[model samples]
Structure formats: structure tokens, C-alpha cells
Target: MELSQEEILARLAAISQGTAVEAMKITITEAFKDRVVATMPIEDQHRQIVGYLHGGVSVLLAETVASVASVLNIDIDRQLAFGLEINANHVRPKKDGVVRAIATPLHLGRTTHVWDIKIVDEQERLICVSRCTVAVVEKPAS
Candidate 1:
């Protein structure tokens, strides 16, 4: 049977425990086979020395959404998805408030998935744009 959206979101939340996604306070707001969305607040931990949003945090959020979206597309019982590579361009500086990230698949292949993720601030202005590649492989025996 197919899982409901709430079930999927709950599973995603459970899977994020103790990970960077949890530590960074990134919340997955939407999840689907074709898309995923998440949000993070720009707190002190998310800022660089000059108090601007850290580039690495943005990349992390981008990759997190992409990887989660890939998991949603694959059979978790038999497959595992991991980020292979990601590139991001930080466009605007954000000091405070939440940043929303929207991720959509560019390519969903047998072994890999590519996602385009856009991070926008409260005003919906672009803060970062990223493309992430995730590798889907058979789950290893426990």
C-alpha cells in the first residue's frame, strides 16, 4: 500500500534525528516523488563571521532536500540514496528570518537522480541556487 503524505513526512522526520538536518533545524515542509521543500532559520549557528547566512548551510539544505526527495522516489526497503555531488551559487545575503528551499528533480535515472534546489528568503527572493546529484544503490545487508 502507498503511504500517505503525512506518513512520509513523519518518516522523514524520524530519519532526521541526530543528523545535521535536525541540528540545523531544517524542517521538511513538503515531500513528494517529484519535489521536496524545507525551511531553516538564520540563527547564529547558520551565520558566518560577518553574520550573513553561511554558504555551507545553504548547500546542506539543498542537498538534504534532494536526498530526501530521492528517498521518496525509491524503494527504501531495497534501495539507499546518498548525495554524490552538489554545487551551489549563493546569490543574496540573509541576516535573519527563515529561508525556504524548494527542490525538484531534473533527472531521475536508474542509478542517479539530479535535483535543482532554490533557496529563498521571507520575501521570496533568491538566496541560493543548487544542483545536487544523488546516487541510488541497493541497500546493504545489515
Candidate 2:
């Protein structure tokens, strides 16, 4: 059976417990079969030595959204998705407040999925653009 939107979001949240997603305070705001959105506040921990948002954090957020979206597309009972590769371009610097990541599928094949992710600040200015490839594999029996 297909899960409801709320149920999918709850499952995503549950899987994120005690992970970097939780530590970074990333919240999955909107989730759909084809798209996913998340937001993270820029706190001290998210900043680099010069106090700008860390580029790695942007990449992390990008991969997180894309991977979660991939999981939603596959059969969780039989398939597992893992990020295979990712690339990002940082366009703007952010110091504080929240940034949102929106992810959409570029390619969804039986073995792999590619996602385009955009990170924007509160003003809707582009902060980072990323593409992530997720590998889908059969789940090993427990």
C-alpha cells in the first residue's frame, strides 16, 4: 500500500533520529513521490572558520533530500537507496537564518536515480545547486 504524505514524512523523520540530519536540525517540510523539501537553520555549527555557511553542509543537505526522495520512490521493503555521487556549486554565502533545499528527480531508473537539488536562503536567493546520484540495491535479508 502507498503511504500517506504524513506517514512518509513520519518515516523519514524516524530514520533520521540520532543522525547528522537531526544534529543539523534539518526538517523535511514537504514530501511527494517526485519531490522533497527540507530546511536547516544556519547556526554556529553550520558555519566555517570565517563564519560563512559551510559548503559541506550544503552538500550534506543536498544528498539528504535526494536520498530521502529516492527512498520514497522505491519499495522500502525490498530496495535500499544509497547516494552514489554528488556535486555542488556554491553561489552565495549565508551567515544566519534558514536555508531550504528542494529536490526533484532528473532520472529514475531501476538501478540508479539522479536528483537535482537547489538550496535557497529565506529571500529565495540561490545558495547552492547540486546533483546527486543514488544507487538502488536489493535489501539483504535480515
Candidate 3:
């Protein structure tokens, strides 16, 4: 099943309610199996002591985009996606600006998915590079 961009945003917004992603003001700009893109603003709340974008925050944004992309590729009614593992390298820091994270699949398997996420500042400078692995699990009976 395929969803329109607006539909994807609505779904992502629902998932983000009251979560850290919502606090970071993440906006889903593009959503598809081939690629997913999101943006987050660098604010005081997201900064570390040195006043730069927190490395953890970059990893959070990375996982969010990659995990959501994994979810988008699965059967929503029967399966759910969860982060199995993730790693990030913060190449640069942002003091104040919006950072965009683009996630593209490296492997989409029956039970697992791997994504490569590249985060860039508003000026298109690389901020972080991340790889995320997601496990696709059968939804528990509820």
C-alpha cells in the first residue's frame, strides 16, 4: 500500500504525539519507501552545554527518519517497526538552524531493514551520518 505525502505526515504526526520527536518539532517533508526526509530545528532545548546541536539529538533524528521509513514499507495492520540498532557520526554541529535528515534504505528484508540517514543543516552542510537497523515484528494481539 502506498500513501500520499500528506497522509504520511498525518500518520507520522499521530505517532509523534507527546514524544521527543514532537518536542524537537520534526516535520515529515517527504515519505516513501525509497526515501524519507524530515527536518528539525536547533533550539536551546536541543542544544548541549556548548550550545551546539546535541549529538544525541542528531542520533534521535536519524533513527526517527529511518525507523519511520521502515514502518512505511510494512503492513501497518499486522506489523510494527522498532529500532534494533543505530549508529551515528556527528560530522558537524549546528548552533541555530533547521537540520534535515534524509533516510534511504540500504536493505529491506522480510524481518529487518537497514537505512542510511544523512543529516544536513539548512545551508546543506553535512551534520551527521547514521545507519539504523529496524526489526519488523508482528503486532501483538491487543
Candidate 4:
């Protein structure tokens, strides 16, 4: 069954309420057509052995932000997108700073979605970038 626009919006709001991604304190700063923005403060727990922010954290941010956008763009009833392919490139290292990730829909098709994800620091320097492909699948009956 295809979801109404209001249903989709309600689902998004419900997911935002207790999202596991929220554990990272990833705040949605802005959202618009085909795009969404999320921000996080990099702390020691997110750092690597060398005191630089963990590379995995960057990847996680990219995936989370991209997933959020793709989810909102798709049919919200039974269909859902699962990560198919994701590639990340880290440009700079940081230990303590505010990091923001912006995800934009590159392509949204019936079976798949592609997103371009970018992360920037407090100084507005690009810290990480990624391209993600999510496979749209049917949600199982409850």
C-alpha cells in the first residue's frame, strides 16, 4: 500500500523521536527537497587511537544522513531503502570540533536511490565525503 503524504511525514517524525542515530546526537539542522542536513559535535569518544576523529564515525554519519534523505523521498508504506553501496573519503582529521553532514539525493528510482554525502567541520572545511547507493525493499508485515 502506498502511504499518504501525511503518513510519510508522521513516520519521519516518529523515527526522529527515538532514532538510534540520535545516540550520536546527530541533530537534523535543516531539510528540504532532496536534501537533509545533520550536525554532530566530535568528542574524545569519537576519536581514534591517535586522538583524531574515528574514520568509522565519519562513515556512520554519511550513511545515517543519506539514509534519512532516501527514506523521506521514497514511498513510506511497505517500501524501504537498504544500503547497497557506500564509499567514503576523509579529507581532514579532527579531534574536537562540530561536524555537519549534508546529504543530497543524487538519484531516486523505484528500486534504488543514490545519495551524495558531505561532512564539514566548524571551520566549514570538508572533512569527509561519500556516495551511497540504497536498495529499496519491501517492508515486512508486522
User: Which parts of model 4 are misplaced by more than 4 Å?
Assistant: 1-19
TM-score of each: 0.97, 0.97, 0.95, 0.85
Ranking by lDDT: 2, 1, 3, 4
State the lDDT of candidate 3 residue by residue for 1-142, as single tens digits.
6667898789888979999889889988898889999999888999999899999999999999998899889998999999999999989868997999999999999999999999998788899999999999999999
Superior by lDDT: candidate 2 or candidate 4: 2
Per-model clash counts, in order, read 0, 0, 0, 0
Worst 10 residues of 3 by lDDT: 1-10
Q: Write the per-residue lDDT of candidate 2 for residues 104-139, one digit (tens) a residue.
A: 999999999999999999999999999999999999
Question: For residues 33-118, what per-residue lDDT tens digits would candidate 4 score against the true structure?
Answer: 58888888887767899899899888888988788787777766888878899999999888897999999988888888899999
Question: What value does the lDDT take at residue 63 in candidate 2?
Answer: 98
Query: Distance from true position, residue 103, model 3, in Å?
Result: 0.1
